[model samples]
Target chain A: MSAEVVPLPARAPSLGPILSLTQTSMNAVNQIILDRMQSEIPLIPALAGHLIAGGGKRMRPMLTLAGAAVCGYQGTRHHRLAAAVEFIHTSTLLHDDVVDGSETRRGQSTANIVFGNPAAVLVGDFLFARAFELMVEDGSLRVLKILSSASAIIAQGEVDQLVAQRRIETSEDRYLHIIGSKTAALFAAASRIAAVVAETGDAEEQALDDYGRNLGIAFQLVDDAIDYDSTAAEMGKDKGDDFREGKMTLPVILAYARGSDEERQFWRDAIAGFRTEDEDLAHAVTLIRRHDAIDATRERARHFAERACDALSIFPESKARAAMIDAARFAVSRGY
Target chain B: MSAEVVPLPARAPSLGPILSLTQTSMNAVNQIILDRMQSEIPLIPALAGHLIAGGGKRMRPMLTLAGAAVCGYQGTRHHRLAAAVEFIHTSTLLHDDVVDGSETRRGQSTANIVFGNPAAVLVGDFLFARAFELMVEDGSLRVLKILSSASAIIAQGEVDQLVAQRRIETSEDRYLHIIGSKTAALFAAASRIAAVVAETGDAEEQALDDYGRNLGIAFQLVDDAIDYDSTAAEMGKDKGDDFREGKMTLPVILAYARGSDEERQFWRDAIAGFRTEDEDLAHAVTLIRRHDAIDATRERARHFAERACDALSIFPESKARAAMIDAARFAVSRGY
Candidate 1:
């Protein structure tokens, strides 16, 4: 995943205001994360900490914290909930890195690379279990139902992605559905559970769910864009890593749809052929740029970002509300 | 895992009575398993079904069902909980196959082998989430707490086993701890939660927990012994697979502790060095036999079996209670 959204110089700032707004709650979340990640087996904490501490803006948990804050929640339970959200996200990352055979994450070697696939897979399971444990402690069936269902959907999304891997015929709709479950389900649950915790009514819960769902889609669209447009350093991944893996991101889908017939063959040869040329990545980038796929993807991200902001319109204006809007913007703009 | 216990022709039957007694509840649990395992992604259930459908004795869920019956529960909540218990067991099997690099389970191709590691791991996560979902639907915080915590402990046990993989110094106490958390904890939780659902008091809960815990440990010990003594057909895995994987099962531990210096070197070279001599498995089996590790392991299993039966002493002599006592005896005696 692209770690953060890169804002244009003209924008006030991305994630900064949101981070500071949720700082106290975020600190508690971090503490819970540290305490919960540890096990009698050192490898769990070691593998988990490597990814969690490598730290790409803890945006999901931030959404949860901000959601609770925006709803005028005064209790400390959101901290535990936020930490649980982060654990779910981190667990997925560990498994994703293994599935993707990724070597780098957050500009460092991936956990699967440092530890083994077995360790990564088992530790991921441990973290997921710990997330549920936290939710159980929170003592709300609704919250548990939401998060657990999100986890199931997330797994489905990952499997769907696996099925779609290297297939040139993968459609934009399919791509959105995959991301909707894989990425946005957790995001939606993270935001929606905050309202549940705050005992806010269904309307507020639905609003926050929409906000997080749209924000997550926007975040992923920009992440897809960053994969093609940014260098290895900016993406915290090898350049054209998506192209290498034959992952059907939006830019690829858009370019494949809009490109000349010859360009379609190039994508097929480069990705689905199972023998990526050394120039395949660079060639893929050129075609993506030539068709303005990156720009189109970013525009779609902007659309979702707007929707995310609109979802929060029901809440009264406050620092939390304003920061949440910036977070939506940040989701689209992070360091691209 | 030892897929099933094959009974000797001369001995009293194992698992048969328990299965017959809980036939109705088992059928309900089985139906739920089929229903809940279904998913839109198809791969989730497909991979899960590949393992779940591979057909082992559904012993864990059987414990949950029998636990409820022994308590004279009339409600259907135990069916859901029993399904949850099976899901937890099935989820671990998926992950465990990947971790063990196992090629066969219950005498069939392992899910990881058939579906690939990525599918195996993600599907495992999906099943686990479904388990939590079932517990949430049951709408009891106590049930949720027990199962989730068991999950965490199981993960820890797997990691601890990973740590002990090739370490000859791995103690019996440490090994027992690993099995306690990884295997018996779930059994304990499964049985105790039945009491929770039945609204049985703490005394009954504790009794059932002890019964299940001891039975689980006893089950695992027999499983370990079976790995050494049983044919590939009997064990449903390659003979000496644990030794091949460098797993510190009880027989290996006993043999290593009791062996000659030459035998120790052989184990070190074969296991820790990660090179299998052509006859390594044969040599290992011979050494295990020479040390009487199989009988010794069976003896220990019998000890746990007695404890399991003793824990059920509080309950009156009913068919359910009698069947449960036989299960403990069956746990140690099947094909030994």
Candidate 2:
């Protein structure tokens, strides 16, 4: 009992490396985003600018730039493509707010809340069309194919998620499938397009896609986990949104599987939207913690993050590769 | 003394010629539409099919087919392109229903009402993405650019219309501009692409574009006129919707401009949404009729329809050309 207990100390993973690696190109991408979002209709730019200027991590665009760097690409083509990827992401976010009736995003008023749902929906359409316009201007049918297919997949994934909402029995596999399409498909496309612009052959393209896809899973899992982790810092989104919305995320899946009969009954009622009060959310967080569901979700995320890092082993070691690896680690480690 | 009015009756313009001209190829386009709309997600097809099979006239796709016939296109490329055009049109219709919160369309419950706004919005996104996927499969960047640009213009026009809603001072020029962007842009693109597939010269492309654009304006003006024309047959939509929603259509613009001081006050309150009862709509309709605004709107539509027919003067006389001119006349003559 008296034996010394030592806590293992490790430096926390950081996005700083990846951020620095892609800084200049990210600026160019940002410029393209700003330039392309403009229209003769003032409302289009006003509503779009609110979210565009809101502080997002710009993770998807960063992946494009970083993938281009890892591929030893010297062209400036990725800049516009990266902008297109961001536009696609932003469009989905706007629509998501309308679907969810969300009030806050990025710790600020959502576009749907700031500009009414009608404006939000229309501007989302404008941005999505603009994204395709950018891809067309780049004259890459290949990129267009990748992004358009991904867009369809993302929409299907959202509809599937809507169908699964408020159902307590959703499996972890189904949740993974939903996120794979809704979140990871675009990530994979974003990274793969960089490889295409760099003229990297199939192997490298596949490698980057694998990397981005796995990292996207890890990121989404952690996001779900953080929603139920009461001890975590506030995220850009409102906390407990998934719980209130009855989204069957991984932590809820794990907690439901591990809970006692009474706890299971509670989950069923809560997820069916019968229990949305503060106490219900608190009980949910407590039950999730008691069953170690948050830790389990983080464990799953760590596995994917490791796979994501190993995906780059096909390429030679470089600063870009190292930074990308670090970014994957950060994806799993954030809000811990 | 009595005036004997001999009603001049030319054979009422019919879509018969155009319909027969494109019937065979339209079947091919229909097959493509059915084949492409399917997905493993059952709801996508169920919701999409409800509207796709909901007895729409397939006007936009027909335009594509008719334009192809007019250009004497020998190949089947226009079939797939026509399906793509229909998908774009269907996607916009779905979104429009959601934006307008419409309960009925085509004499049936709207997709938004049956499937919920979330499903309608997501399915709309899916169809829009599918439209681009089709374009990508065709491997034509020029067509992609045309459609994408048109899509953006449509979105902007919708936003502008939303801004103009409930504003009594909206001008006829503004209304025309909005319709030009929202409705006519797609028609112009649908027609122009046929020329592209035919490898016709720039002049031919411009002529077809002019034909479709003017025809679309005529079609929409008639649509607006029909909304307030009580003597006309019930349309495939809820009558008085424009009045209830305070949309600034041409009839409303002309009526607002021509109303007496007292009548103007009634319009001011009605357009501001303070007056939505049945009697209020009745009074509004009476004012429009008293001012002959419905007839004025139809007269405007006729001018555009004549321009549409004249646009075909450059082409040699043929079955297709004659059918297209009749189609223009039909655009103005419907619901007279």
Candidate 3:
């Protein structure tokens, strides 16, 4: 598994405006998280910091801050909320690596691979618990509800994915449901909670939520596209990692539907056997390209990005709102 | 693993009262959950039912109903709340079995064993997601907050236990923290949510929450005790199951503190190897008994039971309250 680690290009294309906006929104909150994470509980701080500093895009936390900023939340709770979102996201990643038996993440060894499954799972739980503790301090039941519901949905989405594995008959609707629950739900919750915490009305709350949800969908579609397009080194792990795990992402599903009988047989054998041989990988890539799955997926992702921007149109135009829109666009276009 | 199956007794004296209460509660919420579980999504209902019907004490749900009844809740939401609690518990159990690698539960094969690990995990996630859907229907942000926090705490507790395993220096305080988070947190959440939904005062709500927490602690202490004293058949598991799994339960901790040099050596070897031979199990059992660890553990359980009862003193004295107290006592004294 360690042998499969692929180092991606150290630099993504410049996003100066988006980067500056996100950094400004997140800087204060990130510091607070750093301070609060210092704990008497032995080894917790060390483990948490290791994972937090592991070069995550901090997309969930950024969504949270962006939502709050867009809604004119002047208070400090947004920082805590953003931190809580990151903790939940990080915790899930820890458990996910264990479940998927992955060895590398972000060009580094996965926590489960480095610290063992027990440590990874436990640390994930610790982060989750700690996140709750932080939320409790905020004393907003509404925020708590949104975040909790998101956690449940995320867990369910993962489960749906698990059941869908190697299942050729899984519909696009089911696929949407899985991704919505697993990925978009958290993004939605992060944004929506900001509205809830700020006591925004239902209309604005729903709009921000829509923004986050569509952005999340776009993000995942881009991820699926990259899985087929990127080299192992560029992706920070093996090519066809999802395929090796028998995961049926959007591209594969689209390719399978559009491919010839021979292509379908290739999927059957590859997925059923959990095989990621060089030829199988090459064929999958070719099939995705041949069927225009990559282009279709990208188009769908852009549609979501547009939808996200549309959701933000209801809010009075402001720098924060513009930043939030840019963030969505960034999610769709960001390279690994 | 199949060869290790130990059939529990068809009947037990303690189970009579529990079964009666459980059956009554199930009848109330059974159809509701069944109806609500229906989905256009294939495999979800069957999987959800399999999980709900999977044998559990229904302790959390029972606590929810019992808490509401004691608080004089006249509405029907308690039934839904009960089902929600059950779903959360079942989801955790699904994940727990996978994490623990347990083959048997309630004298039957575990979901992970029967359905495979991936299915068990995913189905667990489904139940958790279903739980959120149910929670949103209540529209009480408080209930969502409680359940979500409980979920996070539960996950954290499991992680704490994982990290603490084989570390002989683990404190009783830490043990309490782990069990309270893993087990009592949800129990407390169930009852607290009942009080919240019933629109009770802070005092009564705190009382019920404390009651649930102490009861949960006592329940887990008894479970730990039985792991040492009860047979595989009696306990619905192999004797020394915890010891075999390298779990550092209260009995093992107490015994280790009191054991001779040789006995300590036995524990060190058992945890390291992940099993204890029959003779080693016998020796460990003898040391636990001789050191009065069983009685000490029982005493601790009783203390918590008393604390649970004490918390209910402020509640209007009624049959429901009496039953709640009896339930706590039964938790510790049932097998004895």
- Interface RMSD, candidates in the order listed: 0.8, 0.5, 3.8
Sort by TM-score, best first: what order?
2, 1, 3
State residue B89's C-alpha deviation in candidate 2, in Å: 1.2
Tell me how far the alpha carbon of residue B156 in candidate 1 is from the true structure, in angstroms, after superposition: 0.4
Better of 2 and 3 by TM-score: 2
lDDT of each: 0.88, 0.93, 0.78
> Best by lDDT, which number?
2
Docking class of 3: acceptable
Better of 1 and 2 by DockQ: 2
Residue range A1-336, candidate 2, lDDT tens digits: 699978898878899999999999999899999999999999998999999999988999999999999999999999999998999999999999999999999799999988899999999999999999999999999999999999999999998998899999899999999999889999899989988999989999999999999999999999999998888888888999999999999999999999999999999999999999999999999999999999999999999999989999988999999999999998988996
**How many backbone overlaps does candidate 1 show?**
7
Clashing pairs in 3: A159-B122
Poorly placed runs, candidate 1 (over 4 Å): A1-13, A231-233, B1-11, B230-233
True contacts kept of each: 0.78, 0.75, 0.32
Angstrom error of the Cα, residue B102, model 2: value is: 0.6
A21-114 in candidate 1: lDDT tens per residue? 8999888899999999988899899989899999667989988999999999999998988989999999899999988899998789999899
